[model samples]
Target: MTATAVNTTAVDLEQPLQDVESCLNLLGEALHRRDSAAIELHAASLHLALAQAIEQFTAAARNGTVPASLRTRLMQAGGRVAAQRESLARATAALDRAIDVLMPGEPTGLYGASGKNERKSAFGGSIQA
Candidate 1:
């Protein structure tokens, strides 16, 4: 039986991570413009794109099509993006908490206690306390 060859070369994950960063920067610009709708709309698409890029990089590395430097870069980029993602998530959570504290009663609000409707919508519980 003939054995199949496996490519062990790593892909450069940095380029895609850089792309992600650029996308994020664009998103920031959109936010700076107070384009809430635009930011919200693009955020998901940007996230998906970054994820796909990472996936492609990893796959290329596994397939041995990626060069050593590219592979290292890909790994590094993945780590960087992971860190950035965590930071963003934490910051977002903090911001939400702050908003919750500040607003305390808006269902459709971003930072607040969340209206009864939101509680119900998310947790299926009434906010009658």
Candidate 2:
């Protein structure tokens, strides 16, 4: 391949790397702010950007060595993303518990047939023969 072709390939690979870095930065900021909407928005873009970056990086690596600095940044971003995911999962679980407490479902095994202090059905009137 000509020098110009090599230069173009290098530039193409660089674009995706930059995009991935930018997406990671935005995602980190959104997580820090605890802005769910912004996080959702950036998360989608980040997924796509990261995929593209990985694909390009793999291709580039086959032809030449990837820079250590970029690899370091990618690892750091991956760690941050994992932490953020864990935090979100915990928060979601807490919210789910709170909702269940606030609006509980029907009690199970709380009462039995012909048992003293048995709970009555929702319909006020008692069951007739």
Candidate 3:
């Protein structure tokens, strides 16, 4: 292929990588603010874009059409995506552990009174399980 054609293809491939980066940035913002909906949307979009770009890059590499610079960029982006997923999984597991530690029991409202004298307190309400 001509140099101009190869350059154009490289530029086209870069667009999707750029899109994935922007989506990841948005997802990070949403996660920081605990915006669940925005986080889900951005995460899904980023995943899709990254997957598509990886497929394209892999196909080009197999055909010996992808330039060395583009191959390096794709590999770097793939590494970043994998690292992000690992970070997300770790954060989720930490949150689960925190919730378990903080609220670790069924609500048993027994205001220190005997069963016979278990008259309800005015300020406390029983939450029936």
Candidate 3 stretches greater than 4 Å from native: 105-129
Model 1, residue 59: distance off in Å is 4.2
RMSD of each: 10.0, 5.1, 7.4
In what order do the candidates fall by lDDT, top score first? Answer: 2, 3, 1
Clashes of each: 9, 0, 0
TM-scores of the models, in the order given: 0.45, 0.68, 0.67
Candidate 2 vs. true structure, TM-score: 0.68
Candidates 2 and 3 compared: the better one by lDDT is 2
Provide the overall lDDT of each model, using Cα atoms, as 2-decimal numbers: 0.61, 0.78, 0.76
Model 1 agreement with the true structure over 1-129: per-residue lDDT tens digits: 112222322224555656766766676676557576877766776688678776877676555555556556546655755764676588789999999899886455534454323333455765556
Candidate 3: worst 10 consecutive residues by lDDT?
110-119
Local accuracy of candidate 2 as per-residue lDDT tens digits, 37-126: 999999999899989888887886787666666667667777876886798789899999999999987666656565644557588766
Which candidate wins on TM-score?
2
Tens digit per residue, CA lDDT, model 3, 40-76: 8988998898888877777666654877777787677
Q: Highest lDDT among the candidates is held by which one? A: 2
Clashing pairs in 1: 10-71, 11-70, 11-71, 12-70, 13-74, 99-111, 99-112, 100-111, 100-112
